[model samples]
Target: MNESGNPSQPVNVNEYDASHIQVLEGLEAVRRRPGMYIGSTGERGLHQMVYEVVTHAVNEHLAGHADTIDVTITADGRIRVADNGRGLPVEVRESTGMSAVERQLTELSFAPKPRTGYWVFGGINGLGLCVVNALSSRLTVEVHRDSHRWTQEYEKGIPISAFTRHEESSGHGTAIAFMPDADIFETTRYSFATLSQRLQELAFLNGGLAISLTDERPERPVRHQHLDGLHAYVAHLNPYPSSLVHSPAIGFTSENEEQTIFVQVAMQWNTRPPGEFRSFANSTRTHEGGTHEHGFRTALTAIINDHARRQHLISPDDEDITAEAVQQGLTAVVSVKLAHPVFEGCTRTRLGNPEANTYIQETVREHLAVWLDHHPNEAAAIIRHILNTSI
Candidate 1:
């Protein structure tokens, strides 16, 4: 009791019971904290939802279950992604007692790791589709499996109708259509250029994985596809004859069985200004240079400096080639695939695995050394370019 009050009301501990602690079910938690799943409610987040969906289809292609994926932006602002893969299972999952399609759409923590060596997936812990479902105003899924067609519809993460079965289908695949929620997003319009660039990169990263993007909102629908892989990517970056010092980019792949990691690199020295270095881990782009990038740079600089010294291109007293000097006018793609990746954060823009560094460094060093020995002219040209930059 307070001194100034005659009596004070006793607090009732029983009032703060389990009933007061509300527990969110299934996608409800995702809707409440959408940013946690997709990064933001802004334009970037809006695009991420589309990417999440596309990544799944691409993963199927990587796993050898599919070869083609089509991404279309409708005139009505709906995004449609279709793939020619074994459709999502329509039967009920024993653990959850919900149909596989329903659980995949609604469950937040339902992502299972893909089979080792079959896929280099980049869908961010398998929560991609569930987040897309929670943030969309309307979503429809069609699956052609077991020679039959199955369909389901959802609105804002909840089922609008029961799963329906149609007559037997000739083909097998999965298609998803969705409209972004106006209440959760600042804008629903998809950027054609952004989608094109990302899809092109995906095509290059996963060789022969055909992906087509179409925009029906414009006067003439736009479509883009890449089939020649990273070689084509390097050629695109250095289009003119004068742009490339070396006619063809040197490309190679190396693997470490113990760590279950694979590394692929494509490199060319051009006549342009500062060059570009694109790096990836498990087919996911790493914009920020991490351990793998660091290792690559280290090995590249060392190899060039060693070759220059042996060829008498540089004086013994001259300082070793700096990373900046070695990278000048160079265009390179460094891609690594690992069974389990340790990324800097959920964004996965950087790799944190220490073993990746050692793997990449050794691979680049050993392979580049032999290539320099075999191609004296190209090696000399690269050394001359680096020498000019150092001076």
Candidate 2:
């Protein structure tokens, strides 16, 4: 207003003082801005809450602490997640005199960061159990450990009572049941199909992990476990399975020991478009393909083009096939496990680590080249398919 030569009113500079600097202690920040942590207050966010809890259990399995995870949608609109794993430590903390389980649920500071040489997919966005608890109207946890059973209850992120210990339990594990806060979410109803697809993908992504989804609302239960892992995943995603250029998917894994990164790839070409080309980092789907995807595509195009020229399938003067052409009719899954994966955003939809590119590129280059050279018939068929698609 002053620059425009208009009469300006007196401003209260004191109005923007220390009182405006409100500090949100404990889990209050999550509740004040649920969308900032959960991405939305709609159906997607509701599902994300379920994913966070399930992901925690999956991490246990990834760390070799657990093997089986069971998820149930109760008739009363509550989610129950149980796992056969080493339960959360119940030892009392010296600073707060609270058990580890209570601290994990009540404080956001407990979220673990990506450390060296450990494979985990929990709280990568700095939101996990605590966020789940904050946005939940009612949450209960049961821990079977230390040769005894421990239990606790919370209402709207506040502990209703102290943790109680019971008689010795037979085995060690953790079970959590939570009801999403109606005030925070647009809808508390869970989607069975959406949750099933993700759980199935997780099972395929992490081989030998058993996961079961039970809809207690209707008493429907299904189990998912894949020893063949990504190979089975690619086959399942193939839309043109009958028209595959190769009978079985080509799968391989490579590791960069110094960097502590592991890449696993499974690929199969078909005679159709709109095929699946999925990528994941640290067991989280990278919806927006990032460095890892870039590396995979670059290596694939180079290998195919070089092979075509060497085999005289294409003249030396012919332009190298584009990455798009090489990927046409492709059904592949690229999964990379990095101890310190760098995701581009809080949503974790894109990978950003530069080292991931080199790791995946080299892995694909070496393994794919060998596969093509070993299987001339399948390789030629794949090349022909690409050429036809280009035409």
Which prediction has the highest lDDT against the true structure?
2
lDDT of 2 by residue, 1-391 (tens): 3445666766557767998899988789889998887789999889888888888788788778888999999999999999988898899979878998998888887865433354556343545888899999999999999999999999999999899999989889899999999999999999999999989999999899999999988988999999999999998988565778887999999878675898999999988784689999988889998999999999999999989998999998999888888898899999998877888867778999998998888998899999999999999999999999999
Q: For residues 95-151, write the lDDT of model 1, one tens digit per residue.
A: 866888888888877775674463455665777888899999999999999899999
Supply the TM-score for candidate 2. 0.95
| 10 residues in a row with least lDDT, candidate 1 | 219-228
lDDT by candidate, in order shown: 0.84, 0.87
Clash count of each predicted structure: 0, 0
TM-score, cand. 1: 0.91
Q: Give every collision pair in model 1.
A: none
Look at candidate 2 and tell me the lDDT of residue 283. Answer: 83
